[model samples]
Target: MAKYTLTVNGGNKEVEAMEDMPLLWVIRDLLGMKGTKFGCGQALCGACTVHLDGVAIRSCSLPVSSVGEGKITTIEGLSEGCDHPVQKAWVQHNVPQCGYCQSGQIMNAAALLTANPTPTDEEIEQGMAGNLCRCGTYNRIKEAIVTASKSL
Candidate 1:
């Protein structure tokens, strides 16, 4: 096992984990932060997305060692009071159904807006294409993104 001190959210977290352990496990298991869910265990699914150094990435397949000193941000870190524009927009548009994928969805949406504060419809579709919502809330998700973009 190797010891890693990760800068998560706005704080520091130290954990001991196998070098090959996925960051998702490190975040959810060792770190005990359940906000980042486990879904496919593969990178193809965006359900395990998180922000690494302010960029959205699939944590399920990312080896913990590769994270190095990069800052990590989970859904819990997205907003302390749940007032992030995307989060508010999510509620406004009623985007979640089963809600299993909503954390990842929110994290990805937050990152998308950060990179492009005002994204076109095509751009929003493309940016959010990888995130799959099992409840088939794509239309509502799109509407939330459009709404969030306006607030940003």
Candidate 2:
């Protein structure tokens, strides 16, 4: 086991774990931050998505030791009172059904908007292609992204 100090949500978190340990487990189990979900361990699902230094990454496939000094941003860190533009747009558009994939969806959307403040429908689709919502809220998700962009 090795010790890793990660900058998460603007804070320093030190964890002792194996080099191959996925950051998803470290965040959910060790750090007790459950906002980041575990859907597929193989990184095929976007439920484990999180922001590593402002880039959307599959935390399930990211080894803890490989994070280095990257900043980790989970759904809980997205906003203080869930008032992020994307979050507000989500609520305004009623974007959640099961809500399991919402966090990752939101994180991915946030990262997309960060890189492209205003994205076309095709761009939005391309950007969010990785995140899957079993509830099939694709239309609402796309609408919410456009709404959030307008607000931004």
Candidate 3:
């Protein structure tokens, strides 16, 4: 095992783990941060989405050693008391169904808004395309993203 010092949510976290271990496991299992979920370990699903230096990435497929010095931001770090604009928009639009994929969805939306505060509809669609909500809440997700953009 090797020691890795990760910058997560503006804090430094030290963990001892194998190099091949995925960041998802490190965040959830080791660090006890459970907001980032594991859907598909192959990186196909967006359920493990987290911000790596402010860019959204699939933590499930990202090895802990590969993270280097990138700042990781999970859903829990998005805001205090889940009061982020995207989160607020989600509540306003009632975007959760089953609530399994909402964390990743909200994280992705927050990153998109951070990069492009006023994204167009096509941009929002493309940005959120990777995240799948089995409950078919895509319309609500899109509306929430748009609402968040306006609020941000």
Candidate 4:
């Protein structure tokens, strides 16, 4: 086992984990942050996406050792209050169906807008391509993103 330290959601955390243990497990199991969901163990699914030093990463495929001291942001950290523009837009657009994938979708959208506050349609599509929403809420997601971008 190895000891790794991470700055998560504005707090510092130290954990003991196996060398190959994925950060996703550490976040959910050790640290008790359930906002980052586990969809697939592989990196193909974006459900485990989190901000690692301001870059979106699939936490399931990332080793705990690689995240030492990096600023990690999960869904819980996305909003200080309950009013992140994206969250508001999501409500305004009524984007959730089953809601299982909405957290990943929102994380990806937040990353996209952080990098490009006013992304084009193609950029939006490309940025969010990795996140899959089984409910087929793509149009609503796009509309919410655009609406959030404007609000931001």
Q: Name the runs in model 4 displaced over 4 angstroms.
A: none
Residue pairs in clash, model 1: none
The residue pairs that clash in candidate 3, if any, are none
TM-score winner between 1 and 2, please give it: 2
Can you write out model 3's per-residue Cα lDDT over 1-152, one digit (the tens) per residue?
99999999889999999999999999999999999999988887799999999999999999999999899999989899989999999999999979988889999999999999999989999989999999999999999999988887
What digit string (tens of lDDT, one per residue) describes model 1 on residues 32-132? 99999888988776999999999999999999999988999999999979999999999999999999999999999999999999999899899999998
Q: Pick the candidate with the highest lDDT.
A: 2
List TM-scores for all candidates, in order: 0.98, 0.99, 0.98, 0.96
lDDT of 1 at 58: 97
Q: What is the C-alpha RMSD, rounded to one decimal, of candidate 1?
A: 0.7
Supply the TM-score for candidate 2: 0.99
TM-score of 4: 0.96
Q: Estimate the overall C-alpha local distance difference test score of candidate 2.
A: 0.96
Task: Give lDDT tens digits, candidate 4, residues 1-152.
Answer: 98887899898888899979999999999999998999988987688999998888899999998886789999999898758899999999999999988878898899999999999999999999999888899999999999999988
Candidate 2, 8-54: lDDT as tens digits? 89999989999999999999999999999999888887999999999
**On a 0 to 100 scale, what is the lDDT of residue 106 in model 2?**
98
